[model samples]
Target: MNKVIEVQKLSISSSQGCIVEELSLSLEWGKPVTILGETGSGKSLLAQAIMGALPRGLEAKGEIRLLGKTVECKADIEELWGREVAMLPQEPWLSLDPIMPASKQISLVKRLVSLLNKPKSESIAIDSLARFGLEGSEGKVPSQLSGGMAQRLAYLCATSAGGRVLIADEPTKGLDSSRKQQLIQLLKEHSNKGALLTITHDVEVAKALGGEILVMKQGKVLETGCCESVLNAPKSEYARSLISARNLDHQRGDLLPNHKVLLELKGVEKSRGGKTLFSNVDLSLREGEVLGLVGDSGAGKSSLADVVLGLVQSDKGSVVHHQVLTRPKMLKLYQDPPASFCQSITLAKNLEDLCKLHQLDRKDIPRLMSELSLNSELLNRKPDSISGGELQRFAILRVLLMKPKVLVADEPTSRLDPIVAGSTIQLLLEQTSRINCAVVFISHDLELVKQVSHKVVKISDYVANHSSELSSPLVTV
Candidate 1:
């Protein structure tokens, strides 16, 4: 069998030091491989290394061969990237042209491949959109589309290139189960035609692809073997912990006898462009309850959260709070935290500033930071200097400092790895529960929603049923 790509003792590093160390693997033309690991574990670094698109200030050593031809230079890797090997990035939005309409962007890709003329590209784009339950969204720009829709469009554009090897990094992130299944099928089709290297923290995605698994951590390979055998019976301690970490038991004690409804939405109606997003919807969050808001992309999940957060007003509705509404009384956790921060400021200064505004005690900062597994040194660093996972944890801690009665998290963990995200969620739950805060957890990750929520609300007609078998009894690391 002809090998599509081969890696021998690959080491990726930067001025600060190594990120991926002496990683080695091979991918055959007919087979697909999944790389699984925790956040900042070098899974994505490996993918970028193979594509020859490592971020600035980063370089690689050792050998990488594509189609049996050695790729030792940036020029060589660039030459083969789009033509022979394509990638679906982790943040699809970053890869897309913000100004371009989804259809036109895809059409442009088709034209580039010379597979069809401009006129024919529309039909292909429409068909692709329809497969992902986005039939009428072709004319929409990236901003107009929901995160999941944008991600689907990104997949269409990348795979549309017809490359011999596809490197998909977290392709299914932000997708509901139906859309996720469609993407899985699409990836399988691509794998049948060529080779696939998927970097994911999703176990179902790894198993659904039915290929070998490569587990990495802290830039090193911990284990690699057939998917079933390795995931089911991981020999490496880290791999076993990684696989078992996702399992969570949602059982909890009953709400305190004095638990009261902290926030309520009464007869809420929201509409945009003459279309009713949702109407006459009533919801409530009680003290210590983790309310899971489940729905498809663009089904008004985030809009509803916005209404509660006072970011967006409903066309006809009233937000009633059991107590006076104040800046320190309610908080919202966005999917992307760094974007919301004042990046120029150090982490400690940011927290101190927020404390000053809220008149909160700054003494708890160090203790809270320690509780979240955050390094005290990070407080001296600017927001851009830290990883997303760390920033996310910091964001959560920032919000928690106010001790809000109601916390609204909008897909807070969508961008994080499963292990890091899981731990973060656990911390969020523990901290919130300690304060008896009501949490509105918004996410497309059904398994995660189910794992942590006390009650789940479905806004749309259907909730995609995710595979429950993917998780087992979690072993504490």
Candidate 2:
């Protein structure tokens, strides 16, 4: 096998700390390799380093060889990205231009190919869309498309312009099982023709791709081997934990101990533009129980969470709290952390304000911030000075301090790295358990839903059916 890419003693560091350190790996042409790690483990940074696109303030050392050619620095690696190596970002929405039509974005990619003297015909653009299950989305803007549709389109655009190596970062994060299967198949097809490297935390996805597995931690490689070898009998403890975490069977029959009803939605009916988003959607969340809302993008999942949070009004039906005819006591933690915080205000002031509004004492704010691993200095700094993960932690702390009866999280872990995502989930579960609060977790990651949620409710056929309520669970893929 011909080596398509190689990294030797690669190290990356930022002011926060080291991200990737002394990481060395080689990928062969016509093969698929998957990198697995928790969030903030430097998986994405490693990919960006290879693409010569590391963020500002990050420094790198060592060698990155592309097709046996050394790429020393950003300036030395001109025209290499998207030509020799293509990347599919973690957030599909961020990769797309919201105002531009999806088709135009594909056309732009085609034009870029042309500039490289490898022009693809206009028909290729449409054909690519069809291949990715986005056939009729040509005229639609990014916002108009569902999350799954946008993800598919982004994959199509990235893969359309041919490259020797493709780097896909959490490509299946927000997709349904069916779409995930499609993406896996597409990745297999790509790997059969060229080299492919997927950075993901999902073990099932990694196994399906059937490639060499690299398990990373804190910016270092812990284990590397065949998928079955590493997954079934991992040499490292971290690898063992990761593989164990992905097995859903271990979670079977695990129900919340306290099943007291906290929030109930009876015959909920919501509509938009005269079209029913969901009707007669019945759900009851109990103390210590997590209700997961799973569906493809635009499947009324987020809207349901919004309705629970009082951010959106339902067309009909009433929400009952603790068997009383009362509005839901919901607190929402947005996916984007910065959006939830006041930009100009210091972090301390924001937390103080939140504490004041909720009647929380000022002294408790510092302790809560520390529990979330936020520095006290951050309290004095503005939101602009903090990173996304830091801001998210702060937002979570604010919610924790408020101590709402019901928590509605809107894709809270989507933007985080795998380790960070897992940690955040654990924190939320722990806090909810301590407070005996019912949680409605809205997410695109099926693995996560299966893990944290006591009952899974998928948004299909316009009805919310609990896991126990159904005679047989429907596996869409």
Candidate 3:
């Protein structure tokens, strides 16, 4: 293996605290390297540092060499970026220009492609989109595409840019199993041609890619070794815990106790403009059971969540809670942290406002902050200033403070690292247990669905197959 990227004594810090410290690693050409950590573990910071795009006020101290050539730490580094290395951010919407068509965004990367090879720009763009499963999606804008589609488009742009090094931050965050497999295959193909540095909490993805794996904790590298060695027999306790958590999530039947039905949806039908999204859908959730919802994008999984939260009116049917019906009083969290928060407001203030809206005391903020392991100092910082994982924790805190009888979380930890996702799930489950609240967790990650939920619902296929009898309970897994 030939080293394509090398980092020596890499350290990154922000006003809040150190993001990464003395992180030294290497990526070999035609090989895949994975960086694993929990939420708030600075994985994104590490990626940004490599691309010389760290946020303002953050400082870096390290040596980074690409193809044995040292990269200068100057403003011109942005010029070197995209050509030498391309990045796929966690949220594709953030990377894309909302006003521009998806095709134009692909065209914008033409300069970098031209730098590498003089292929027809339009042909290359079309080919790249096809490879990413976005064929014929060129006419759509970023806002028009679903979360999964936008993510795939972003991957296409980054990979098509002809960068020698590709850095992906949670590339598979919002994708379904089928699309996940496709993306993984695409990443494998890319790795066979160039070096890949994947930052993810997905152990399966890391294993499937099969390469070096680095585990980081609290801004430090805790373990680094072959993928199988680190995953199967981790040396560090933290690494072992991560593996254990993932295993537990996969083996839900063994870890969770089956209970009687706690909530039931009968003949749930929803539609818009006379086009049925989902109809006659019947589902039941039991106490202490995690029900995993799996389906393609625009598959009505989110619509189902909305109906449960009383946010959207269903055309017909009824939602019955075995205990008591709170209607809109149910606590709900969204997939994207930004969607659930005010970007201009400090985390603490946002939390406080949530409390106030619910007629709660301001004094409860500190206790909630401590419970979620959020730094109290972050209370004053705007939502945009915090890490994705931190924002997720804050969102969880806001919901917990409300102390609703039911928690309807829509892909709550989709953007977090595996460790952070596991931790967040564990925390939510523990809280649910303590409060004895019924939870409705909606996500596209099947593995996560199987791990957390007692029953699994295949929404898209179910609706398609049973349109005439949507009231009947579909296959129960």
Q: What is the Cα root-mean-square deviation between model 1 and the actual structure? A: 5.3
Task: Report the Cα lDDT for residue 469, model 3.
Answer: 20
Clashes within 3 Å, all models in order:
0, 7, 6
lDDT string for model 2 (1-477, tens) is 388889999998877666678878888976789998755567877887887778777888998987777876667666766677778976665578878888778878778764532345456777777766676667788766655677788887787668767999888766777778888988888888888999887778899998799998766899999988998899998888777763333232234555577667777778654447777767777776677777776577877887776677787777776744233246887654555788778887887777666678677677776766666866767875554456678878878777667887767766555545666667777877777777788887776676777777777756433232222353210
The candidate 3 region of ten consecutive residues with least summed lDDT is 467-476
lDDT digits (tens) for residues 60-135 of candidate 1: 8999888777776667766566567889977665688889988888888778764687778878878877877777
RMSD to the true structure for each prediction, in A, is 5.3, 5.3, 4.7
Cα displacement (angstroms), candidate 3, residue 313, comes to 5.5
Q: In candidate 2, which residue ranges exceed 4 Å CA deviation?
A: 15-17, 115-131, 134-140, 143-146, 246-267, 270-276, 282-289, 296-298, 313-329, 335-395, 411-426, 433-436, 443-456, 461-477
> Between the candidate structures 2 and 3, which one is better when assessed by TM-score?
3
Error of 3 at 288 (Å): 8.7
Ordered from best to worst TM-score, the candidate numbers read 1, 3, 2
Candidate 1: how many backbone clashes? 0
Best by TM-score: 1
